[model samples]
Target: MSAESDYVTLISSDGYSFVVQRSSACISAAIRRMLDPSLGFAESKTNTCRFENINGLVLEKVCEYFYYNEKHKNSKDVPDMDVPAELCLELLMAADYLNV
Candidate 1:
């Protein structure tokens, strides 16, 4: 498995949680590191990410992508064209938000 801090948490709309690589999370061009200079007790324990815009179903699919990438960690495989229409849109939105 990858190093721990190398990953971050992603919470789905229904409050489901998934772990994603910090590098992958950086895919979101708009995301900025937390601006706070000091570490507050709350921030340390709740590193889990909160994504308010995406619903549960979409998030499930995004998690699938993350897992898929993990499997292809060494290969430059092209994105499979078999994604469902709804999922495609959701993934796009999620990717856009994460700036992947």
Candidate 2:
């Protein structure tokens, strides 16, 4: 696969498209299964997963956490990820949806 194929685009409910690394996205079990070819979903064929219930902002945060998790996955020290106060509840809901 070429460098561009190493990533996938996740489209949020509001039509925001986020291109994230496939390896990074696998950090979330839900996403992994959805994107897995064995499952035979449209996402696996197109490398594009759509979340109609997840808004763009929540999806963006989840993607950010995925990358952050990867950066600290093998490290002893993990930096803090600060979520804005107002977004805490929404972030939690998104986390639940992502099974992260």
> What total of clashing residue pairs does each candidate reach?
5, 0
lDDT agreement of model 2 with the native: 0.86
Segments in model 2 whose C-alpha atoms lie over 4 Å from true places: 1-4
Q: Residues 1-100, candidate 2: write the lDDT tens digits.
A: 2222689999999999999999999888888888888888778878888999888988988889989998998999777987888888988887888889
lDDT of 1 by residue, 23-93 (tens): 65544443334311143323234555677898777776766666666666687866773578857777887
Give the TM-scores of the predictions, in the order they appear: 0.60, 0.90
Question: What overall lDDT goes with each candidate model?
Answer: 0.61, 0.86
- Compared with the true structure, the alpha-carbon lDDT of candidate 1 equals 0.61
